[model samples]
Target: MDKIMMWVMAICALIGGVDQLAGNKFGLGRRFEDGFQLLGPTALSMAGLICITPLLSLGLEHTIVPLYRILHLDPGMLGGVLAIDMGGYQLCKELAQDPAIGRYGGIIVGATLGCTITFTIPVGMGMLGEREKPLFAKGILAGLCMHPVGILTGGLMCGVSLGKLLFQSIPVLILAILLVFGISRFPDGMIHGFRIFATVIRSAGTIGIALGAFSYMTGLQLLPGLTPLDEALKVVSSIGIVLLGSLPFAEILQRLLKNPLEWIGEKIGLGRNGTAGLLVGIVSALPVIADMKRMNEREIVMNAALLVCGTSMVAAHLGFVLGVDAPATGALLAGKLTGGIAGVWMAWRIMK
Candidate 1:
């Protein structure tokens, strides 16, 4: 199975790489990018769990066990909130606002806002999924505009509080949708500003992960009696390991899935590389990026829109790692796919 999967990945990478070298939009077909996108998060998270958080979030057991055991909390519903919150934070803050996006604080805001406040799987995935900053902007706007059918469904599965759901979560969710609609009225031209608040934050992604990894290793508390440094550090470590040692496997995995994904995509009537896109997370968009036929600007943007707006294995994994209940987990998976498709179609119409 490993060999077969590896062969698949290699062939996919080769085809995608050839397509890209011949003048494709963004997918360059390097093992480096592919590996970083797929394995980066899991690697960083695992290293952190083993080192920093002291197994507080070691596995499903540690992450959600506390909800049931120590805190005497409902692992199903409230866990959904935490799951959504963590996944959103990871995607929006940690992953968005990259070099691909601008370096300004506003880009961060734009990325976060465009990716949607509550639904943020796109920000991270878009970093690699399309690698085009404008598409990120467009997709973010589209993602934020989506209705919270899946989110509400997930919350319901988790047994969330009725009043809180109706009043707090539902209200904010509606407001966010309104914001997206409002933003849609803005012009489509790209403008630039020269001020960058903190150039350091731009590079801080891998650095943050490294610092967290070091902290995890040495058991050092940079700030005593402060926030949960250990947990924070560990999560950072997990996010940072993309460069450390996760790319090779990520590249292999990307290649293996390409042909099958493309085949599935053709069946579904998604241009050409649709399935490749369905699987395109942050950086491993080689399948879509390398497709020679759909190299136009609109095609590129649409492909990314689909991934961020439609697919979200990353969010699902984060929820699973955090020990969200099965019902909530199902909601996250189903909701992102459904919402993403809706967002993509809407963005297509909104594009002017």
Candidate 2:
């Protein structure tokens, strides 16, 4: 019964795709209405959010190590440099810029030039007077998630300190600023480019989901050494996990958050722009993100967003992998929390 319920939700959610063709409320109805659009970017972006980051990292690791061994170089140290602009991280960053039509980008990079650089930057910047500026909340959410989230988290298990991890992100942080500047130069051609890329990526993802689900249901493992089929299953099922894990719980979480968030708003004079939803969004940032209405929240929303920049589940999950009793998890969580608060405050001051 539990499994049936879960599958039913998965089928509905997966088929729903973002909140366009389906979903109810502002996004509160039956999301599986236009089944035709299911094979579109929304579905792919959803799957890419979880799967693309991990698979990209996984594939790169496999490729780099093999090449390193052949060339007699350092195994782990001699890795790859990847600059990918497709997937949930990138796609969402692009979509959030302008819903009716816009171009947004999320970037993840890990390159070693006598040193290692692991960087992820989310952009919400728009052209001056263009009516579409990337929100700090959207940027923060993108930074903290996607495929690279796994690599940064995995670093913790390998004894990398949070400080060291943050240091590596510095380069990407600089690049991210430039990325925002670059996005402000958008034109008609870019939108077309985005759609074309999105279609290709989504088509690949949707097919992977179908193939992967079939393999799982029938207990078949076609690929022996590599994981072409396994990878497909992993990506699709990951989308299911996100939908199952985040959506249903969001309602309950939102209810619990109302009073506390309202109190904070009153105290801070957060006005109509309060970002309590961003905090509530802690459970599943993407869903809360999808539900955001730019017209309502203004300064306070931006403040809330800038406040929580560069923080996410990836950062905290690393600690758990260190063991519940381990000091690393607790330490990292505390650091990120404190840093997030301070960052938000500073951002408010500077942007003001």
Candidate 3:
């Protein structure tokens, strides 16, 4: 499966590259270019955190590990508090006694639970208008309710035993339930809290980058265990490379799926925007969230629910997984897609 995916990416890269050389007649080249364009923002968001993960892991191991052990859980599960690309993987690896659980936590839980906390809630709330916040909050609450489906599915796909999966998920379920309650009862407070949390993470990432750059330029290391800036950048570059293909491939997929999605939307009583949002949200949630003005209330809520687990499956998340752990790409895909679909259904039922 890994090899097949690699070949698929390579083929997509070739197609994207050729389209670029041919002056982007099909506009596929624009997607190719977008991959490179995203590198700067991606690095700004994550590189520093990656560099400083070892330091953070040390603190977490000392403070949190004992509690997790007492609960018969892996400390790596704590990494699910951060987004996958934002040092979650590194932190999980550093703290895990079990490598499989680390992968499960960092990739599966991180992408779903972690991304929702750090990126989805804060960023999505910030992007939407005041009028839309309530609807969005409700959708997120619905999404949170179904997040376990994705986490458990992904865990199983990652070869984690059912007993361990259930045990390890205790903390995630608790946190998710809290999030659900917070968003449902105190939307404004939850939004404010997440914004503060996101700000702290970004600030820490910037400091990590600065410290790494300083250490690289000078022979002296200010922090004893910081990863080199260059090393972190290398990981970013790898994801960028994968994105070159993934973005173009996503464009191709959107084109191919448009008619069917439209037909499905019509049958399901969803408007054009809602159907379109579902397809687009898979590539990245930002564009869909940004364009929510065109959507009706149903569409807005449904799209939000989908974004919880579905966002970036075909683009950023896929690129990141392929770059870091190619073998887990299938599990990532299955988890996000299935979970996202379930979220959408849950939203529909709630709205009904």
lDDT of 1 by residue, 54-158 (tens): 222234344554644454322222112112223323322222123211111111222222233323332233333334545545655665565454344433443
Q: Please report, as a residue range, the 10-residue window in candidate 2 with the lowest summed lDDT.
A: 110-119
Q: Using alpha carbons, what is the TM-score of model 1?
A: 0.46
lDDT of 3 by residue, 142-171 (tens): 888999998899999999999989998898
lDDT of 2: 0.36
Off by over 4 Å in 1: 1-140, 161-163, 174-222, 226-269, 281-293, 296-298, 314-327, 345-352
For all predictions, the C-alpha RMSD in Å is: 11.6, 11.8, 0.9
Per-residue alpha-carbon lDDT of model 2 for 228-286, expressed as tens digits?
44453343444334443234333444567677777765655444334554454343233
- TM-score order, best first, reads 3, 1, 2
Which candidate model has the greater lDDT, 2 or 3?
Answer: 3
TM-score of each: 0.46, 0.45, 0.98
Candidate 3 local distance difference test against the native: 0.90
Candidate 2: Cα lDDT at 151: 36
The superposed Cα distance between candidate 1 and the true structure at residue 80, in angstroms, equals: 12
